[model samples]
Target chain A: MDYLTIIQILDSSLRLATPLLLTCLAGLFSERAGVVDIGLEGKLLAAAFLSGAAAAVTGSIWIGLLAGVAGSLAFSMLHGLASITFKGDQLISGVALNFLAAGLTVVIGQSWFQLGGRTPSLSGDGRFEAWNLPFADAMSKIPVIGPAYDELISGHTTLTYLALLAVPLSWWVLYRSRFGLRLRAVGENPSAVDTAGISVVKLRYAALVIAGVLCGLAGTYLASLAAGFVKDMSAGRGYIALAALIFAKWRPWYALWATLLFGLLEAIGNRYQSIALGDFVIPVQFMQALPYILTVIILAGFVGKAIPPRASGQSYVKER
Target chain B: MNKMPKWADAVLIPLISILLAFFFSGLVIWAIGKDPVVAIKTMVQGAFGSTSGISYTLYYATNFIFTGLAVAVAYHARLFNIGGEGQAMLGGLGVTLVCLAVPWPHWTLALPAAMIGGALFGAAWAFIPAWLQAKRGSHIVITTIMFNYIGAALLGYLLTKVLKVPGSMLTESARFPEGAHLPNFSEILAPFGINFSPNAPANMAFFVALLCTFLFWILIWKTRLGYEIRAYGQSETAAKYAGINPSRIVIIAMLISGGLAGLMAINNVMGEAERLIDNAVEGAGFIGIAVALMGRNHPIGILLAALLFGFLYQGGAELSFWESIPRELVVVIQALVIMFTGALDNMVRMPLEKLFVALGKNKKKEA
Candidate 1:
């Protein structure tokens, strides 16, 4: 209600939205390239675990980040190998990867650390501390505008800014580049792309790689921001990101808006476990269930239609 | 007619995939400095060594059979109903309401009423997703998955806030009345001089699961509705031309699937826990997808797959206790089985098909 409260809410929303934005963009790339990746949850969990573990072992956040991306990339490649090379069902492959990640993280974590399927609590250089933007202190000295900038826009982890920048970058690559053209072509009509002398497999693999990296960053942010990794730490955020992707209708810019909206909803849910509306109390579980319920509403065509890529979820077999 | 044999497709391929998955699971165990052989031995002994062990295994298998059939029925109609978890949760609520609202005079009377309640609740949960997929062009996978989480939250709310027994510390309902409890296997088989583990949760619900499996077979193969479902699944355009309504079939298939999934609560709630406890469905709903996949969406195959998973679950718990292996490793193995038998079938099939072709050629040359 108050301006300070509004700024605080906005701050928390940005913090929460960063991971969703990264993952939504990740899904955008994969789906746009004709791959339906429901394994985003698995990739996030794997990356988060690897990053947190690497950081704990090596005591360097940079190594942790690299390890996380590499781990996630391994899963992305596995998906590609199954869905593309073997001509397997893409959805099933993704589901398998999710199960693999969910199981292996704990199995390996317990074997190594004996910490009940959790890595050591990250501290010192292992965690990503908030960084103040240049002149944030100076900006805070000014009037209303300065305080807003200082409080709402400054002092986030490095990955948060990267997530924001990824949106425009993803938009440009998807709409303005030559590879983007081929990628879009592959999703809509792989035969046409093949006829144009492009390798559909290569294009899809590239898209999956991009998706892997973005998801890796998302996971890294989750672990580093939270200061440690817990079992199933990604929880259902990856699926939530998937819902956000559908809510955005496979667009990059819309992904930002959708994720932020979900993030705002999440922030509200966190802030208010229960709310009094007249004489009735709306429980927090309903708030937690809002995004999923909203997604079902969207998919039910109450708001608008969500038409996927024409060739999405179809395995392309080359004809002689 | 001039192709490979049926046994190779149905039996050999899955056998090879299971072998491959086991091979990888062994490697993972070895990587962790544990004995793979010992792990395997422990799992086997823990799952089937004693009467008690077998009873637990059967108990877990019963849960899988219900959920697996749920998935298989929907899969025949080309629908991927992944919300069995949520549907089962709603089914638990249904069973709870039935047991608590009315005082049944006998278990036999309560059983049928609970079945109706569970099936209806489960069907209601799945109806919206099926409708959306049928008419609005929404993806069934995403909707069903979202519903699973929503169901969990809803069940949690009900158990904690509305259904909690007065002054009870745990987030669960009071135990069901004595008359409402399903008879366990030991009690049921006592007249036949067949002794089952008295303490095991394996109950009359297992027989109900078997009955459902038989009914599924009849509905899918022996009935007119089954013919329509398979016909619609094979080719929607052909079915449409033949006056079959695709939307109607989709809705019908999902309702049946949801009902079957919901029926699993009989085993978990009324049979085992005797109370609507939180997370009683556990991951049985998700495991049902893997079972349906490995079983190739056939009732018989689902039964076999469910038994296999039940072994892993009961065995894995034993391994975790005796050998310090993480219980989640069971999930890894299950996922691998799914990956190979369901998604990566071509990896094994291609080589085997080539072998069969080569063998046929040699036989022709000799002739």
Candidate 2:
């Protein structure tokens, strides 16, 4: 409505989009390497719980981050072992991993904390505090650009900035790097990559590791958002990230915009119970459902053809 | 070409898988400093020791049977229908509307009408995803996942805005009419001199689930449509060459799957709660995936798997009540079962194949 209100919404949008961006890039790497990872949600949840617990117990955010990443890495490796090494159905493996994360987090959390599957709330260094960019105060005097820069671009957790940075980094790693070309090749046709002497299994494992690290960061950021871990804290954010990945058509730069859009929708939903246009009123639930609905429509090829990698979801088998 | 005998494939694999799952679950409990043996004993006693426990287990199994059959049917056509949660929720809405539209003279007439309504709504929820997958080259898995979220949102809006009982803070519809009540297990068994727990929610829907299981077997094995579905699942190209329409098979299989998922509402919503509430399906839809996986997508196998899960659920509840072990322990067990049975089948199968091959060689030497 007003300028300040709009600024506030945009600020929160960036904050909400941080986890999505990180997780989306994570999915991008895994999917681009011919490994379908529906386990991203599980990874996020595990990371969130472990990070929160570590932060609470150790009183160190860095240790929490490490623990979170380790948790996600374990899941990613499990997924790789099942879908890559065992050549099992990738989707089923992901589904199992999700359930495993969902169950294990609460079970372990309840045992350790005895707070009904919640980590103790963190304060001070136990959480990631927002960092204001240099000259934020001075820039506020510049009117439109100042407030916009200060509010929209500046003053977010270090993870938020890293998430934004990852967009370019992912693009470079996916398109400009030598490994990127080979990784893309593996996803499109693993046989060709194999013929070229690149081990498809190794490349996929590497991609999953990268995905695991990114998911770790995302999960830690989520714990930081709540200042602790709650039961099922990831709360479908992983699925939303996957939806954003599909919406972006697996491109890194497009991923930023897609996640931002979804994030904006979420911010708006949180801010308003409903939007009224004259006599017509839109319920908040519609806003909550819009991202998924749009993804379904995009997937149905109404918006554009979102063709996935050919070898995606298929386990590669070497010919004897 | 078969590495193992038919009996082993049908029974041995699942038996071993379940054992592995329970073993791992025990390890988790031990890690948490709890006695896994005591937990298991408690679960067994709680789920089956009393008439109430058995009834509750049966009640939960009723929901699982419907959803498990839903997943199994779709699996036959190679369509993974993960939107069972949404479909079941919508099915509850359908049951609610049917039951509330008029005071039924009797549940005998109401049951069939509610079944139709539930199936229709559930099928309708699944139709778009099925059509997209069939015609537009969209991935059914992603689309179905999206539909689950959408279905939840739709149900939430309907409950808060339209279905909530007036003057009540709870986001649930008014209770169904007296005649719409389905007879519980106690009432159903009373005439036969069988004493059951009157407080248990287990109802005639359990019988309906059993009937559906029988019907599912007939549909999958005895019908031309089932043959076509299996053919399509095995190889779409070969099925096309054999003059079977892939799109038709996909649509029909998904419809059947969605309909079965919807039928779960009859157990949880109509039979148990007698009111439509938010999250009525709970996680049964997702559990259906695990059930179908453990069952190997067979109707009889699904029935057994559903019963196992029902026991776990009832037992988990008892564990939480008695030992405070947390009910999510059951979910952890379920995850392990799914992982070992579905995702890591080769891990078990390879060793068994080797054992069987070695045994066959020994037999040849003896001969």
Q: Pick the candidate with the highest lDDT.
A: 2
Tell me the tens digit of each residue's lDDT in model 1 across B51-80. Answer: 788988999999999999999999898888
Query: What DockQ does each prediction reach against the true complex?
Result: 0.83, 0.89
**TM-score of chain A, predicted model 2, versus the true chain A, to 2 decimals:** 0.99
Query: What lDDT does candidate 2 reach at residue B160?
Result: 95
Clashing residue pairs in candidate 1 (N, C-alpha, C atoms within 3 angstroms): none
DockQ of 2: 0.89
Provide the lDDT at B140 for model 2: 92
Give the per-residue lDDT of model 2 (tens digit) for A134-205.
Answer: 999899989899999899888899999899999999999999999999999999999999998999999999
Where model 2 places Cα greater than 4 Å from the true spot, the runs are: none
Q: What are the chain B TM-scores of all models?
A: 0.97, 0.98
The number of the candidate with the highest DockQ is: 2
